[model samples]
Target: MRTSANPIIADLRDRIQHLEGSVARHKAILPFGVPEIDAHLPGGGLAYGALHEFAGGGVGTVDGAAAALFAAGIAARTKGKVVWCLARPDLFAPALAQVGLHPDRVIYVEAIREEFVLESFEEALRFGGLGAVVGEVVRLPMKASRRLQLAAEGSGTIGLMIRRWRRPTEVGDFGHPTAAATRWRISVLPSEPLPVPGIGRARWLAELIRVKAGESADFVVGACDVQGRISLSSDTADGSGETRRSVHSG
Candidate 1:
């Protein structure tokens, strides 16, 4: 025998699903799928509706590229458009695609001046229908960070700040307190030796410098697989083992 679903019951189920989705969007955390790393962050993942800062450990191009890849991976996980505000003319589209963030999903903005960068970030964060807003700037004051945080909260978007300074001394400026929910420093690390003679995927010393409700910590982990996934070295997941491994799986 075949029976059709009741219209009233079907309507109620749809309503329930909508409510559940609303709750998740308002209070969900995006997991990075690494238990050891998630243990150091509140809610076991990166919180939405807030600002996160990622900075290179040095002035070298490799350092900045590492940070950018990390930030891009985060954006790739989100569900909508991403606005990338930077002045760099050499952003190889292939490199971004390597981390799972395709060019079609990104809206790149070239802001030559620091002031314009801030403005663009704020604008993107305020606008609706964005997954994230990323900005590359040397200076991010407490006030500017607060604005970004509030805007993201209002729009339910994530904000990423990539700090790259011209002078070595200027790098110190990024260590100061800001309204960002979390801050990270990415440093390039040597990769594990491969069975074949070839350069492996990027490895990094990812330092969680600040978190809203967690202590700072560091981990050497593989980042941004072809699928835009990050994972902790299985040996080091418990915080007691060490092993050199490529950022991407073979």
Candidate 2:
């Protein structure tokens, strides 16, 4: 004979499942899946409930694009939808897709100013339903950054802040301190040598300018692939256990 599940037991099971999911989300870490990089990061990857910052090495468009693609690749690896808040309307969806973040997975919010962009970014981070929240701003004051950081920590959603500058002098702003868990700089580099006389995969000089409780380092990495996966250059992948080290802090 078939018997119905007890209502009380069913309700208890549902509650247990919800708790488990919440715990997992709180403990989540998005790994780059590259040992060289992961080994240096705390918890072997980026903590889910944290804010990270990225900037281009130069004020040029190419370096800025590289920084954006780097963030896009990281967002692509995450689950759920991504909210991207930007003051500029020049985001290239096709390029993002090339780096593995498809347009379908993103909700683009074009704000009139950086303050508005930060507002949208904070809201998305607090909502917690999205996979990630990204905001592009020229500068992130400590007060504004603290608010975003708290929101992300409460919701267990990752926040990516891209620092875009129009003038070389503006690059000095990145040196200011903020609440970001880590700060990175990406610069375009020559592609790897190809077997034949054709262009090869793009590369970048990825500098870990600052990381929470960790020393700064730099790596020459291949550009994100179609699946949004990045790999260490052959020099770093040969198991020599070497990474370019620099002294810096957040």
Candidate 3:
């Protein structure tokens, strides 16, 4: 196997090789750098070159913004430019910058229709040189998600699908199955208390709704900081804060 001086390129090559079945399943994983969250993942991090889904816990704008920022924070840690495909043109680039995904590093592809958004998303995933590809769509069918997953695996690029609905009724589509490796729902929570009398860091209820081979878990975490890192809530450790929950615990 050929190797590049750049570690990022090397990892990308490894992922492509793994997808071709030329090597063992040694795909690179992106750790959130939080042991509490990584402990639940199979590889102690999110697998590269895979499809993951994210959604808001409710139909409110606050929940939706939280979900978008969560995805942006994850993408910020990657190595290359990001391609964002969306049907709506309402994205605020400044808000993404606050989450560490600088607007300069992102390429926005605004399509008039959701179908075009999905098409752009899949094509970007196949391009292979991007840090990540994000698609904001209302519906993602199993077949479409499978194609996205395969494309991501082929190129070693991460694919993030944000399930957003214009109508509250469309939220029900989230219950449908997909080929994503993991599914998450984010809800805005009250910010952590401050030392004085000012606002503190934002808090979120991050729910791992599904994983490929891991149990679902819920955590109350502080919002991503300037470095795109999330800290576990201190109150949770003392049992005074919201209780963490896990489904089918062993």
The C-alpha RMSD in Å for every predicted model, in order, reads 9.4, 7.1, 7.3
Q: Could you tell me the TM-score of candidate 2? A: 0.87
Report the C-alpha lDDT of model 2 over 67-184, residue by residue, as the tens digit. Answer: 9999999999999999999999999999999988999999999999899999999999999978999999999999999999989887999999999997888899999999999899
Candidate 3: lDDT of 39? 83
* TM of each candidate vs. truth: 0.82, 0.87, 0.88
- Ten contiguous residues with the weakest lDDT in model 3: 18-27
Which residue pairs come into collision in candidate 1?
222-247
- lDDT for model 1 comes to 0.81
Clashes of 1: 1
lDDT string, candidate 3, 65-137, tens digits: 8999999999999988999999889898988999899988999999999999999999999998899999999
How do these models rank on TM-score, best leading? Answer: 3, 2, 1
Off by over 4 Å in 3: 1-26, 237-243, 248-250
Ranking by lDDT: 2, 3, 1
